[model samples]
Target: MDFRRTSTALTREQKLAVVSVADVKAQERITNSYEDALIGQYIEAAYDYLAGPDGWLGRCCLLEETFEAYIPNPGGGFELPIRPVVDLSSITGFEVSDGAGGYDPVSAALYAKSVNEGFGYILHSGQSSWPISIGVDPRRYKVTFKAGFGAADDVPSPIKLGIIMLASHFYQNREATFSDNRITAVSRQIEFGLRNLCGRYRISRDHS
Candidate 1:
């Protein structure tokens, strides 16, 4: 093995680092299916919904903002973060719910609309890098509710399942025939951009 030669294989240090990150991500993807607890069932439902051509699991269908992540997805990178945009000015229905920390079924419904609006911002806004810049774009989420009973229960079991299943993709290892230079270049960019944000969250560019 020529250590100095720039072959397709990763160097010893590079491979180890990538493997470590990949392992952590893989653990997250593991679905606890012993008694079909919090994760297993949810993932199954997502797969079921995605079984058909119109399952609405692809990039355009469900996700509105997807560029840097999907455009040049990195190694051990399957778990994708999708943000949709919803216009506060247009939403005409129930009160808007903000799931900043967390959310239940009802909150998820309203938040989903808001996320779609963010997606629209990404699609049109060409000033920034891609999805992240757009997703972070300042937008308002409306909360409208009439004096009535607990908001309509649109939180179906199938939807929950899909969410779980969609998350599973993150654990799976990706195989690329030809490694692209962009992966390394993008990681460098990530490292540079996140230098200031490091103390808060651990961010590094170790794409092998």
Candidate 2:
């Protein structure tokens, strides 16, 4: 099984557009410069929650990273081919360790047909169990995979809407929500609206 660490595909400018912030020119001293900066932060926050680690809004991205599959239950056998993975698109590197401090690359053809759309990969080596030790450390079973919609431009509309709505709401209401002088909760209506829009993007193992 494989797990991954992903990077955000949205840029500050693209995020600003999502939240409907006024674009600032190179040397323009906009009156709401401070607000603009805050808007960027809010966008970051929205994206972080929506598409960060375990986030469900699977935006498309390039092959940015690969990670070791830290399988927690090697004793459980081959029940889990991919470990709590994000939206995996393709595998770039698949290597197994000999448990004697040597590594061998697994052929792509072996696992190519095992990828399911929403589920993770399946290992089919005509064997009942997967290799338990892919590395000397037993935790370095590794496969580099790609995931996301394809690129930032290809982010799903629902996800983009969620980011815009959340960022705008938070920016407009930041004062009361986080101000030292006037700490207050977000209104129920606003809370409900944001939840309805953004909560669907949350990844839940219980009901996913």
Q: Which structure among the candidates has the greatest lDDT?
A: 2
lDDT of 2 by residue, 59-170 (tens): 3221222333444333322322322234434555556665665567755544432344433453555434455643246344555555544445555566677666666666
Model 2 vs. true fold: TM: 0.62
lDDT of each: 0.27, 0.50
For candidate 1, what is the lDDT?
0.27
Reference-based TM-score, model 1: 0.18
Please provide TM-scores, in order, for all candidate models, with all chains considered together: 0.18, 0.62
lDDT of 1 by residue, 105-192 (tens): 2233222223232232112122332112123312222222111011113222333333432434322313331264466664454345
For every candidate in turn, the CA RMSD to the true structure comes to 20.8, 6.0
Q: How much is the lDDT of residue 205 in candidate 1?
A: 22
What are the runs in model 1 whose C-alpha is more than 4 Å off? 1-34, 37-56, 60-83, 87-118, 122-158, 161-208
Off by more than 4 A, model 2: 1-34, 54-68, 72-89, 100-102, 107-113, 125-137, 176-187
